[model samples]
Structure formats: structure tokens, C-alpha cells
Target: MERPTRIGVQLAPQHAPMQATIDAARRLEDMGVDAVFGWDHFFPLSGDPEGVHFESTTQLAAWAVATERVQIGPLVFCNSYRNPDLLADVARTIDHISGGRFVFGIGSGWFERDYIDYGYDFGTVGTRLDALAEALPRIRARWDQLNPPPLGRMPILIGGKGERKTLPLVARHGDIWHSFVGPDELSQKLDVLRGHCEAIGRDVAEIEISNGASVRDGIGGVGFERLDALHAAGTRLLTIPLSGDDGPDGYALDRVPAFLEWRDRKNG
Candidate 1:
């Protein structure tokens, strides 16, 4: 059966005070978005790479209590930032607080500054993927080893677009595969994912396909026709990342209206 479309918003944890960030999350929830996410990093990705930013897990733990209805998580937690077993426990605790509304989004580490400044080993891409590959099973095992386990199974969302390592990991382990790609590119990668799934004897449909939408003119640029194509092609969860700076007038929150409208129509 086809799943209903869902919209998620990443509040972009950059250049904002904690209170403002919390308020933004609450507002996004009240506006009827399905999930709220923030990226996992010690520094801002844009503006200044060394600029002030909030860490994903800490921010998410606060967000768990700040909003009751919104499902919250990191867009993708860097696996190198914390030990796998410890990360699983942290996610479990947050899941309990959120009443099982936490999606454990995780990925192999990127960003050399985050690693070097934080005193983590800055390894090669192959080595990092290798680490992630080793860590996944251990994280799952540790979850089971915990006294109560997770609030639920704690759906795993794996983010990345690497065909060689990341997509295979998604095929084998992820409940949702989140990535950003243009429509044609996404279509092509879906084919790659299918090949990965087939090699592993796993059904590709078992994993929810998620894509990022670029919001413009208070609406997503791809429009309803493109959205339909995505849905028909197995993209179940679509998210738009709204930065405070993405607007013409600065700090515009109007994107949510068009996003919600599209989500409603697609789900209907």
C-alpha cells in the first residue's frame, strides 16, 4: 500500500539563541509540520564554519520536552561525535521523554573541523564509513542490552547519498533513508538503492524514501506535479529545511504555509 506524504522541517540550528530556537520548534509544531529536525554539528555549516551553533543531541533533548506533539530528531547525528553504545542510550532516554516520538537519525561523520576541534580522529571517508558500518549493529545491540530497551524500536533514519557505502547501509539497516537530490538525480539514486536492496535480498519498499525540498516564493519549487512524481516513485517523506536566512526579507516563516498545504494535498 502507498503511504501518505509527510512534511518535516529542519529549523537550522544556526545564529539563534536557545530560547528562540525552542520557540521556533514549538511554532513549527503548532503549524502542523510532521517532524522537526536540526543538524548535528558543533559549528555552523554556512556563514562562518566556526560560528556559534548548538549540538544536535543536546538541543533535541531540550526540544523533546519543549513540544509535545512534534516528532523531533537530528537531521543526521554524526556517529563520531559519541560512542555508539552511549549514543543509543541517549536516544533511548530522549525517546522516553518524547513518549516515543524520537527518530534516531544518524550518519557517518563529515566536516573535518568538527572532528579535529573536538579531538576526534579525522579519518578518511572509507575509514569513516567503515566505522559507521561497525557501529550500527553495536548500537542496536546496546539498545537491546539496556534494561527497558528503547520506548519502541526507535525507527532509524540514515542520511547520506554515497552509493557505495551509505546506500548499502540504508538497504541493510535503515527504516528511512534521508538525502537531498534534485528530482532527476533522486530518481537515479532510487534505482541505485534498488540494486543495493536486491543484492541484500531486502525489499526496497521497506525503507521510507525521504528527500529535501527547496522552498521558494513561500512555496516548494517543484510544485504538485513533481511531488506526485516523487510519491509515485516511492518518496514517502519530504522535508524542507528552512533557515532564518533563506528569505528575502530575512527570518520569514511563511514557507510553512505552502509546505503544509502541499503536504495536506499529497496526503489526501
Candidate 2:
């Protein structure tokens, strides 16, 4: 089935206190976002080098309980930090807590600081992708073996733009593929994803397309032209980044409603 257009807010879990993120998640849901995502990282991706930051899994559990309607998960949890089976169980627990509103968004690890500081081996990009390749099946197998499986479908959202390893992985495993590219390049990327799906005998339609958009791009910064084009190209989900330092609250979600309104119109 074709997925409806969705507006997702990626609440950056950095610089602000934990409560700010929690509060933002709650309010973002109230604001009518379809999903709320947090990033998996040990330190701030931007801003202060040693600023306040929270862990993704813990925050996701709290978000699962704090909201009633929206889906929750990391933008892309790094596959390096946790064991595959253990990660499966943790995600299943959160899925139950969310009443089955969780989306498992994952990616091969990339942040060097997160690895170096945490004592994880900072391997080459190729090695990390190989590890992720090895982990996906193990994670799925463990999910099947769990005493209580994930609450619902627990759709897996794989995030990346690399045409080689990443796109192939998405074609084989993702229910939703989150791409970092914008409208101008989306068509070309989708072509690559489709080719991979064809090679694997997977129906390209089964994997929902998700792309990152500047709030302005969707809400009025440039205009909805780009968003319109993306929708035409088959992207059903759009995630806009929220800065912790944008305002008093880490969310900076003022523009969310407008984008959501756009989504409603598109879906309607």
C-alpha cells in the first residue's frame, strides 16, 4: 500500500537538558507530527564540544511513553555500539512501550568521536558497513526468537545515501529508506534504490521513501515546490531537523504545524 505523506521532526538530543527534549517530543506530537526522531550519538554533533547530551535509547523509551499518537525512534541508531540481538530486544521493549508506534531507524556507524571516546574500535568505513551487513540478519533472527516479539510490524527504517553498500542494504532490508539528499538529486538516488530492489527481486514500492527537508523548504523558506517534487518522486515521509539551541525549548517547532498542514492537504 502507498504510505500517506508524513511530517517527522528530528529532535536533536544535544546541548539542551533531557527534559527539554522530552517536553519537545510531547509538544511535537501535540503539534501533529507523524514521527519524532532522536540521533544516536555520545556527544553533540554541533554546538559545544562538551555540552549536555542524552542517550538515544533511553530518550526513545521515555518518548514512547510520553506520547500517545506519534511514532518514535532514532534518526539512525549506529549499529556499532550495541550487539545485534541485544539491540533487537531493546527495540522490542520500546515497541511494546510505544504501543507499537516505534520505527527502527538504523545506519552504519560514522561519528569518529563517538567511537574513540567510547572505546569502540574506530574502523574504516568499509569495515563498519560490513559489520552492519553482518548484524542485520542476526537482528532479524533474534527478533524471531524473542519470547515476546516486537509489538507490531516494527518497520525498519534504514538511513543513508551511499549508492553501493547503503542502497543495497535498504533494498534488501528496509521498510522505509531515509535519504539525506534533497529534491534536485532525489530522482537519481531513487533510480539507484530501484535498481538495487530489482536486483534483489524486492518490490521497490514496499520501501517507503523518506527524505530530509529544511523546515523552510517545506513550510515557505523556498516554497513547497521542492516538497511537491519529492512527493511526485514517491517520497512519503519528510524529516525536518530541530535545533536544541533554537529557542528556550530544544525543539524549535514553531514551523511544524504549517508543514503538517501541508501534509494534511497532500494526504487529503
Candidate 3:
């Protein structure tokens, strides 16, 4: 059976105050978004480079208990930031806090500023991906060894667009694969992912395909027009970001209700 199309909101954890972000999260859940996400980065990706920002896992714990019914996670946690075993434990704890409503989104480290400011090695792409590959097995091992285990199977969402390292990792471990690629690229990537899955005797369909969507008012450039082709190419999930920078009032969620309604229309 095909998975129902789902809508998620990525609250970028930038520009706004922490309280505002949390409040926005609760509001989004009430407004019927299926999932809520935060990006893992030390500083703001937009607005003032030194603008207000919060750590992903520390805040994800708070978000877990703040909103009922919405799956909560980082859009993609950087693998280089923490020890794999500790990361697994943290994810498990948040999973327990949410009563099993957690989706673990992770990816190889990127953003040179994050690494430099935080004093981690800013390695080459190959090295970072290799670290991620080594870390995945350790995370799985740590999860198995946790006292309570995770409250559920704990879906892992892997984000990256590379066909070489990223797609193969998605084939082996990811429950969801997220990327910014539109329909055309996604179709080609699916072929690569299928080849990887075939090598392992796994079914490519077992991994949920995901992409970003633009707001109705053109707040984001993720291209809502391509949504149909994206879905036709096998994307089952879409996420839109809400930023305070969208306007002066706050995180501009005024447009999100319509987007959620669109999700309903698609599901129907």
C-alpha cells in the first residue's frame, strides 16, 4: 500500500526567540501539520549571522513534550557534532518523551562556519561521509543497548542528494530519504537508489521519498508547481519552512493553513 501524503513544517530555529519557536510549534500541530522539524546548526542560516539560534537536540527534547500528536525532529542533524552512542541515547530519550512520536533526521556534516566556530575538524566531503557511514552502525548498536530501547521502531530520515554515498546509505538504513531535488532529479536519483537497494536485496519502495514545498504566496522558492510531478515520481512527504524573517509579525504561518489543506486535497 502507498503511504498517505504528509505535510511537515521546518521551524528553522533562527531569528525568533526560543519561546516564539516553541509556541509556533504548538500552533502548527494544532493547525494539523503532521510533523515539526528544526535544523541542526550553531548559528542562523539567514538574517543576522549571529542571530538567535538554538541547539537541535536540547530543543527537540522540549518540543517533544510541548506538542501533542505531531512528530518532532531535526530536519537533519549533523553527524559530526556529537558522539554516535550519545546521539542514539538522546534520540531514544526524546522518543520516550514524545510517547514514541519521533523521527530521527540526520546527515553528514556541512556548513564550514558551524565546524570552525565549534572547533570540530572541517574535513573534506569524502571524510565526512565516511564518518557518517561508520557512525550509523554505532547508532544502531547503541539503540539496541539502551535500557528501554526506543518506544517505537524509531524511523530514521536521511537527508542528502548524492547518488554515491548518500543514496546507498539511504538504501540500507533510511526509513525516509529527503532532498531538495525536484521531480526530474528525483526520478534519476530513484534509479540510482534502486540500484543500491538491489545490491542489498532491499526494496527501494520501502524508503519514503520526501521533498521541500514552497508556500502559496511564494515565501519560499521550493516550487509548489512541481509538487504534482514530485508526487508522481514517488515523493510521499513535503515540508515547508516558517521563518520570522518571512515578515515582521512572527513566523509567517498565515500561509501554512492553505498548504495543509492542499495536502488534504492530495491525500483525497
- As for lDDT, the candidate ahead, 1 or 2, is 2
The 10-residue segment with the lowest total lDDT in model 1 = 214-223
Give the worst 10-residue stretch by lDDT in candidate 2.
213-222
**1-268 in candidate 1: lDDT tens per residue?**
8777898888788776687778888888889989998898888787766555787888898899999998899888999889999999999999988999999999997889889888999889999999999999999999999988888779899999999999999999999999876667888899999999999899998898998766652354545666666677778788877665555543356767786887787777
Cα RMSD (Å) between model 2 and the true structure? Answer: 1.5
Residues 1-268 of candidate 3: C-alpha lDDT, one tens digit per residue: 8689998999998888888888999999999999999999999888889888888998898898898899999899999999999999999999999999999999998899999999999899999999999999999999999999999799999999898899999999999999999788889999999999999999998999988886653336654557778888999889997775777867988878877776788889
> lDDT for each of the candidates?
0.84, 0.89, 0.90
Runs of candidate 2 with Cα error greater than 4 angstroms are: 218-221
TM-score to native of every candidate shown:
0.92, 0.95, 0.96
Writing each residue's lDDT as its tens digit, candidate 2 over 38-143 gives: 9999999888878888999999999998999999999999999999999999999999999999999999989999999999998998999989999999998988
TM-score of candidate 1 against the unseen true structure = 0.92
lDDT of 2 at 49: 79
| Candidate 1 total steric clashes | 0
Rank order (by TM-score, best first): 3, 2, 1
Q: Global lDDT for candidate 2?
A: 0.89
